[model samples]
Target: MGNLTNAVTIVTSASSGIGAATAKRLAASGARIVLAARNEDKLKGLVSDITEAGGTATHRVTDVTDPDDLKALVGLAEETYGPVDILVNNAGLMLFSKWEDTAVGDWDRMIDTNLRGYLHAIAAVLPSMLERKSGRILNMSSVAGIHVGDGAGVYGATKFFIRGITESLRQEVGVGSGIQVSMVSPGVIDTGWADKVSDAEGRKAANELNKGAIPPEDIADAVAYALDQPTSITVNDVVIHPTN
Candidate 1:
């Protein structure tokens, strides 16, 4: 394993949950962090905390669904900390709904944020990384992508899309370029996401599913491990879940 000393990193959806945890973990490892999320107050607080802890950090209020916002976010990172060495695509939505309910709105939200958002971030960073021929892109995926669960069909589909893109990126860029593409798939992380589900029956199901939840820090550690590697070595994929 290699250490992350002064590695410029960008983490999306860093206001809470896995993104926040991952940002903290990487910052503690001596990485310069640029946090992106829609919550300005929370982003400011997180930046303050990281700075207070002797880590380099900054944030921009961003909506991942917006391509222009992603461009500005990457530009901010570049202006503040030089070239981005790592991009953590973690901004996402997981609204659960049964197919019978036909919650088209929730599905669209999931696709917009979870699917398009990831692509936007990747597009913003990949070009510079390709030019430098060195960088890391870690896509946050879900176990739902591999194994479909009840009431989470569209959410699972987005993750499946993530899996496909991550693999394609790895093969296309990693083989020739010095960039490393990785993915982390977590199951039932306790990110307070279950309580945020809007659908009544979906919320009930989410709550039931979250009973076996693991802390977000667990996934954070996994992400750190995946990234703290030399360029010659590629940590392709890590799947984490609660034993229970």
Candidate 2:
């Protein structure tokens, strides 16, 4: 991995799960981390933990569904650590149910947080990155975006959009700008995301899948790999799954 000593990074949904793990991992690698999430207490706790471990980190309570909050997150990173060398759009929600039984509100929440939220973050940070002519944007997509399943129709749609947008941005940014856009698509993993699964059968199946799921830290490692690559090399997409 290339040196990340002076890189400044912003990681959204960073209070827990994969986002939190990624923040810690990057900080350990010597990046100054700005953690954003809706939960203030958890975010503060994470910052404390990272600092105690000799990693530099700070937190901001951010609701990714709001564009202003996304803008504030990027601005905060700049105020504290200068230009953000990397931005990880990891904030997302997963609500699963059969198409016929799904609630409209749940569908809307998934779309807003999982899809629109990523777009908002990108819009917030793109101009600055363009001006600097160097940056890395990492979007947290999922394997569900690649394979259609019975209960994950809307959720998968959002992730698929992420994949598409990341690729499009990668092309739009071009090689001369030194901006790398990448997406990490992870398989089933152990996380509180299952808390939103209202279907009994879906919950049961998800629990079974998570029994042998990859750790959140594994996905963090994938993020580190993408960010640690030489500035001239871009890892367009990485799909990580548990061996089991």
Candidate 3:
């Protein structure tokens, strides 16, 4: 295990849920955190809390779906702290819907946020990391990607896409670039995502499944464990779920 002392960490989707939890956890480890999300108020409050607790942190209002915003986020992090040492790609959408419902809009939202968002953040940070030849990228995924549940067709597919990219990125950069790529796939973590489902039946099913959901902090712990390792070791994928 290694400490996160002075690590410059950028956590996207950091206004709430897993992203927020991960930011706080990493900051506690002495990492300089840069929080990014579309919500300026939440990001400001989070940064305040971290600094008040004797940690270094800043906030950047960013929309992950926009590549320029992601690039600006990276730039902000570098100016505020230093070059990014860790990137936590946590911005995502999980819109549950049945295949027969033809929830095309939900599908597009998920693809843009879950898939494109991740890629955009990666592109924004990877060049700097590559130049340094040392950095970590942790992608947050879901169990639905591995074992799809009812009414999560498009949402699960997007996660599946994350899984694929995580692996591909790891293969492409992990061996030669000294860049660690990892994935944290959580099962039924209640981030209030169930209540956000737009489809009626899908929302019902999601709420029911969320009954067994774990807290976002659990996944944050997993993220810390994965990142707080010696550069020689890569945690790869951590699949965390409730023991029911």
- Residue pairs that clash (backbone atoms under 3 angstroms), model 2: none
Quick one: ranking by lDDT, best first? 1, 3, 2
Model 2 ranges with Cα > 4 A deviation: none
- Tens-digit per-residue lDDT, 1-244, candidate 1: 2458899999999999999999999999999999999999999999998999999999999999999999999999999999999999999888888999999888989999999999999999999999999999999999998999999999999999999999999999999899999999999898899887889999999999989998999999999999999889889889987888
In model 2, the worst 10-residue window by lDDT is 201-210
- Residue-by-residue lDDT tens digits, candidate 2, 1-244: 3457878899999999999999999999999999999899999999999999999998889988899998998888889989888899999888777777756787899988998889899899999999989889999999988986667888889888988888889888946788988889999877877767777766765666568778999999999998888877888889987888
* Backbone atom clashes (below 3 Å) for every candidate: 0, 0, 0
The full ranking of all candidates by TM-score, starting with the best, is 1, 3, 2
Estimate, for each residue in 1-244, the C-alpha lDDT of model 3 and write its tens digit.
2469999999999999999999999999899999999999999999999999998999889999999999999998888888999999999888877889998988888989999999999999999889999999999998988988888888888889999999999999999999999999999887888878898988899889989999999999999999999999999999987998
Which clashing pairs does model 3 show? none
RMSD for each of the candidates: 1.0, 1.4, 1.0
- TM-scores of all predicted structures: 0.98, 0.96, 0.98
Give stretches of model 1 more than 4 Å off: none
- Name model 3 segments beyond 4 Å from true: none
Better of 1 and 2 by TM-score: 1
* Model 3 lowest lDDT segment of ten: 1-10
